[model samples]
Target chain A: MKKLRMSKATGINFLTYALVIIAFVVLQVMGNQGMLSSTLKGQLVPICAYVVMALSLNLTVGILGELSLGHAGFMSVGAFAGAVANVALSVSVPDTGLRLALSMIIAAIFAAIAGVLIGIPVLRLNGDYLAIVTLAFGEIIKSIINNTYIGMDVDGLHASFVQNTLKLEAGGRMILNGPMGIPGIQKTSTFVAGFVLVMVALVIIFNLVGSRSGRAIMALRDNRIAAESVGINVTKYKMMAFVTSAALAGAAGALFAQGQNTIVASKFDFNTSILILVFVVLGGLGRMWGSIIAAAALTVLPEMLREFADYRMLVYAIVLILVMLITNNPAIKNFFESTMGRIKSGKKAKGGAEA
Target chain B: MLAFLNHVINGISLGSVYAIIALGYTMVYGIAKMLNFAHGDVIMVGAYICFFAVASYGLHPILGVLLAMLVCTILGMVIERLAYKPLRQAPSLAVLITAIGMSYFLQNSAQLMWGTNQKMFPAIFGKTPFSFGGITISVTTVVTIIACVVIMLALTWFTGNTKMGKAMRACSEDKAAAQLMGINVNTTISITFAIGSALAAVAGVLLCSAYPNLVPTTGSMPGIKAFTAAVFGGIGSIPGALLGGVLLGVIEIMAKAYISTQLSDAIVFAVLIIVLLVKPTGLLGKKIREKV
Candidate 1:
């Protein structure tokens, strides 16, 4: 029975992977055939980026059961760090794809460093306190980025905070101009890259969730004291999940930034964090496939609602609330489950009766 | 020296507003165990109501404030019933998301109702600065400080003495136990929301009076800062909220005054992080022991 259950879980994972591949192929074919609109085509990379973000956040919020409100802080760190790496590498790395790949790696490393630093003190707290500290950290990161000035010259890189003291040479170029962020970034992110990143994220998360450490993390999440009594290292497991999630988010941020001509610190503000949270929550927390669908649907939803103009956000908010209420309602959940169960059983009963 | 004193006064007044806002957060979190993200949006709505009442309709500032509070009280109860009540048994994260949705709903509604334009909040008090001993203070500052002190004292007394307040305390301690003890947890939560929203109205009025800019997004930053203050002080502690708000305000002002202005917010949050690292439950938060 246990082996059967394991096979079932793997089967579902395979289904998820298949769904992604099929979707990618269909979209690619459609794009090649000129069947996709420009707005939708532009949204594809961002949708992937958001999908990775949702999945990463689910690692922390769903799997680890720790609420982090500063996921965007890590994203911003990755974006700026990745953008800078990409720009700096332009001199040495002549290949665009290679440069983008290296930049994402650098971005992930920086974001992981940030995650470890933040998660160290932050993970010591529990519940809302943890949430608030993450929020404070997010704000702090944004503020620091807002005041930061980075420029690269022949003399190497110059960075300053709260002042424009970058004495660049005649050929020096500004990488990050305080609040203005990185401008004229090479649009190196492709839909294919995004798709591959999503697959990579899924593989990492699935393997982790299937591993002993993942079970330990989930154990700690479900019952901290019990897990501790069972000799699980709470801080270590929590940090592992958090830092991994942050690294993945960093990669997504890098992809998102490289896909755009310009990236600003403000783009990864609290609202963006909340928006990603909405996707994760709406997707049903620990369900990875649910996250992908929710992220893709919601990312496209705003563009689809462009006709509503001013009321777009208002409608989205209402839909969010309604979805939460409906999904969480036990009565509605029971009703839906019963109907689905009956539909399956009825089909089986019909086959038996025919036989 | 004179400039420093002025900054302190400005800090105190600003801190007073944060204290008022933080009180609402602390109370709701205490009772409901959910961060009411819409609390900040309620502050915005209150500010808009008061703005229109006083500026557009020429009502007395006091009357306008009262009207705003009344309206916000109803709005708070409505939001709690519609958006939050159904999610009572849901996960805290789900409730939090619902609260975020409510916040977005309120902000967008405000933008749609009142065009997305910043309106200068009228100075309720005349343009007069009170100066003494080489120190200048605006009347709004004095009024705000007085109002904060009064509200704090009243809240402390009410929570310590009133029957309803006792019920709220019971609910906060353990909702199941409180319900078993025949305390109406739902009504208490609703009342907490009402009082919190009413305080939000007063906070909105004072916040705008000091800064005097009214926009749909005006309350959001301050709301976040006040939420930070609530956590800084201790999530559910009233005195902690007051202390946290004042210290945050002072630190913010001092950071901006002495350090780089742009980095002040970072400094303030850094201080919060340090404080939390030292006392994970905040300055005055009681540590709850876990049992398996």
Candidate 2:
């Protein structure tokens, strides 16, 4: 009887995966046939990127129980690293596929390095202090990007190494026109690429959570002293979670930079970090599936409400407060639990209690 | 030497404002153990209140300042009752996030109500300068310094001597014990927020008068900086917040002067990182063991 129940559950999980795959394929086909609007197609890249960011951030915030506001700093580092790699590789190879793959790897590696550098000192601090330090780190990175000078000056327009590195010679300089942002890069991002990335991220995160290391991290979140007494290396697990989340965020940042026709430093400001954080919190922390749904829903919500531009953020703030109130209310939680309990009991009674 | 003196004056003035704002952060954190992220926005709200009082009602700047403080005190109490009281027993993170949500709500509401365009704060000092020895100081700077010191002294006196202030101190030390001893925790918490927010209002008025530029997001930078000051001085230590604020302001000014102006924020954060690494409890914070 237990085996039969297990088989039924497995079948349901497989069906869910199959449906997701089918939906993705349909969307891709529609997009390629120009059945979908370009605006939505353009938005797809960011939506995918935000999903990676939100999920990765959940590792630290939701799983490891740490508040990190400097995720954007890591993303900025990754974006720049990826842009440079793409530019350099194009100059040397001039091939599309190899450059895309290599740049993503390079971006991930560089972002991970930055993650370790920041995590060493920041992870030592707890709570609001950690949050403030991370926030400062993000702001500092922005300030540096704004002030630093790099690459060529052509007709009063200055280009950076990222833009110029790809060109065979003088053309490379045309790529990153400094603060003007890199333009005209190949839009290699497709529905397949995004879907594959999301699937891989989900699989890795799921497997990690199911593993001993993931359990250790979650245990640390529940009770740090108890976890420590149980011989869990609290610091090691926290750092691992932080670095893993940073790497994922970095990968997302690379995709975001490469996917867009134009990129600017200002786009990845403190506000962007806060927006990503909103996704993690509003989704209900520690719930992976909830985060994914929240990310997609919030991403699409703003676009749908674009006509009410002035009231958009105001409404978002209201919704955020409302969600927090509703989710944390004990009365609401009890109501849902009791209703679900009754339904389950009714089904059990109808099916026969002998099973 | 002259450049150093100039930086010193600039630092002290900035520090004075930071110290005033940091008091709000430290006070609220002391009693509730919750970081009031909206405290800075409250400062912004205070500034706007004063702006309306001066611009719309045609009141004197002094009267405007008092009115702003009064309004902020009431708003602070309302926030405590509406948002914070319910989350008293929730985990620290819940209250922290709620504070952040409130911050965002207040900022966006300000933008929606006042519009996003920057408003000019009228300069009350009228280009007056006071010279002492070889150095010259703006009248606004002198006034701000004097105001900060006077308020600090008044607060110290109030907290040390007054009945309600003593009750607040007792509550901060132990909420349940204080409640058992017949001190009303709810009223004490509300009063703490009121006093803290009123101090923020004073800082806001001084900030606007000195800079004369106001925007909805103006509170964020100063807010973060003041929070940093609060942490640097020690999260719950009032005098430590003052010292830390002064030190932070001086460091920032010096960094802007000696190093690249762009790197001032970076340098301040680096100091924070170093401080946290060396002493995680901040400069004056007492180490306490957490109970499992």
Q: Write the per-residue lDDT of candidate 2 for residues A1-355, one digit (tens) a residue.
A: 9899767645644553564477578878898799987777778877877887888888889988888777788777777667656665665667766676677778788878878888888888878778878887887776666554334323333433322332233532554444565566666665566676666666667667667999899999899889999999978988888888888888778777888776666677777887788788877687665667678788988777779888887787677766665566566657878999999999999889667
DockQ metric for all predictions: 0.84, 0.48
Please write out the lDDT profile of model 1 over residues A1-355, one tens digit for every residue: 9999999889988998998999999999999999999999998999989999999999999999989898899999999999999999998998998988899999999999999999999999899989999999999989989989999999888999888898999999999999999999989999999999999999999999989999999998999999999899999999999999999999999999999999999889999888888888898878899999999999999899999998999999999988888888777778888999999999999999999
TM-score of chain A of each: 0.96, 0.82
Please tell me which predicted candidate would have the highest TM-score against the true structure: 1
TM-score of each: 0.98, 0.90
Clash tally, candidates in order = 0, 4
Model-by-model lDDT, in order? 0.93, 0.80
Q: Candidate 2, A314: how far from true, in Å?
A: 0.6
In Å, residue B24's CA in model 1 sits off its true spot by: 1.0
lDDT of 1 at B242: 96
Question: Residue-wise lDDT of candidate 2 within B208-227, one digit each (tens)?
Answer: 98888899988888998999
Q: What is the lDDT of residue A277 in candidate 2?
A: 82
Per-candidate RMSD vs. true structure?
1.4, 4.2
